[model samples]
Target: MTTLAVPAARFHPLRDSATMLRRNLRRMVRYPSMTLMLVAMPVVFLLLFVYVFGGTLGAGIGGSAAGRAEYANYVAPAIILMTVTATVQGTAISIAMDLTEGIIARFRTMHIARVSVLTGHVVGSVLQAVFSLAIVIGFAVLVGFRPTAGLGGWLAASGFLVVVTFALVWLAVALGQVSKTVETASNLPMPLMMLPFLGSGFVPTDSMPTVLRWFAEYQPFTPIIETLRGLLTDRPLGNEPWIALGWCAVIALGGYLWSRKLFAREDDR
Candidate 1:
């Protein structure tokens, strides 16, 4: 009997990552509504804020009028980013869901590359992230929010955000694996997604209460907000971009290690 050992290098730079993503893309095209609903969830939240709570909340932000443009001006990016945060956990849930139902056993019995399964989810979420950003941006444009920074700036902001999303997907994967139920996966992203609310997101941290201000000014969200705002308004680059990247990297590695730990415990590493 001969056994072929797979090198660990197989996963780095994600050689199988695109292949996994392409497969999901085909699935997404086949199940358009499923993807649309996923894309729509954040838009639903946007609508809630825009119509139901926007008028009053606008004053809380910069004054009145939280349209898809002005209000979304501050929020649309975060809202789009939230889609990644929200869906990345789905990968972990996918793993755990399959595990709980013995579907994982079925996959393993077929000798699929364990990495491929996880990669598939990450890649799919990336596509979802792009679609989410496009939908939010399209709504923002329709509402009169023009990117004063021009196409290059818009693309730059989008690219940075995609990096942020890339980092977050891994965190979600970890959480989904760590969680016990699918419901937990669905609920866990809410808090982390809301972290930006307390930071320099909707309003400047300077306007916040003294003690509360300190925390909001320093958390990961602060940097992310500053980076996005600077890019959109053509303001000076703040330290937020670096800080945001650092935060993302830390969270991603931690979650990746955590997911690996969980994976190993189930007789696969």
Candidate 2:
């Protein structure tokens, strides 16, 4: 009698991740109001700053056009970054909600790739960030923010934004794992959203107090903002692109490792 050999099933992390990504994306589509609110907040900030504060801010920045145009150009990059920072907070809240609702525990019992679960949240958040960026930039153009970058520069700027979004979403994932409740997770990522204000996003670092300027110059968001501004506005890309990329790499790796450990510990429980 010949015995038949059974082939073992192959596990594919990429395929698993894609499936999870679809699941998360579907959830976003089903619950559209929250996403709309998230998009609205940044747009509100853009309108407020451009219309209300533009005259004084633009005059200070020394531009030739109407104050609105100059301020629009100056603030658009930072607002794009703000869109990213705001969008990632939702990732933290989603992950925390899953944990609280016992969804993650249910997932633990499934015979699927583990990282795929986290990848779903990360990819979903990144896509959301991209959409938010597009909305904000479209509004910026409508308000007279004309980017001087060529096609290659726009592509590079997009790549940079993707990296920043990936890093922050991973950080959000880790934050979610550590929080006891969804509310806490939602609140924890607030600092990430606020970091841009403390940096050179709104005003020139030179105009800040000596100590504040030092901190702004050294912070992670400042380089990212400067690099983005350089790419979009034809400003010299002086070392900031490399620095921002390095910062994103470090944050993403750290967050990934930390979240993995948290997930494993929770699973063992």
Q: What is the C-alpha lDDT of each candidate?
A: 0.70, 0.90
Model 2 C-alpha lDDT per residue in residues 60-156, reported as the tens digit of each score: 8875445878888889898899888888888988999999999989988888899999999999999988887888899889887899999999999
For residues 1-269, write the lDDT of model 1, one tens digit per residue: 99999865423336555666677678667867755666676677767666666556666676554433556566655666556655665555555675677765665565356676667777787777787677776865665456679888888888887887777887787777777888887777677778877887666688889999999988886787788877887878867688888998887788778877777677554
The pairs that clash in candidate 2 are: none
Stretches of candidate 2 exceeding 4 Å from the true structure: 1-10, 63-66
Best by TM-score: 2
Against the correct fold, how does model 1 do in TM-score? 0.81
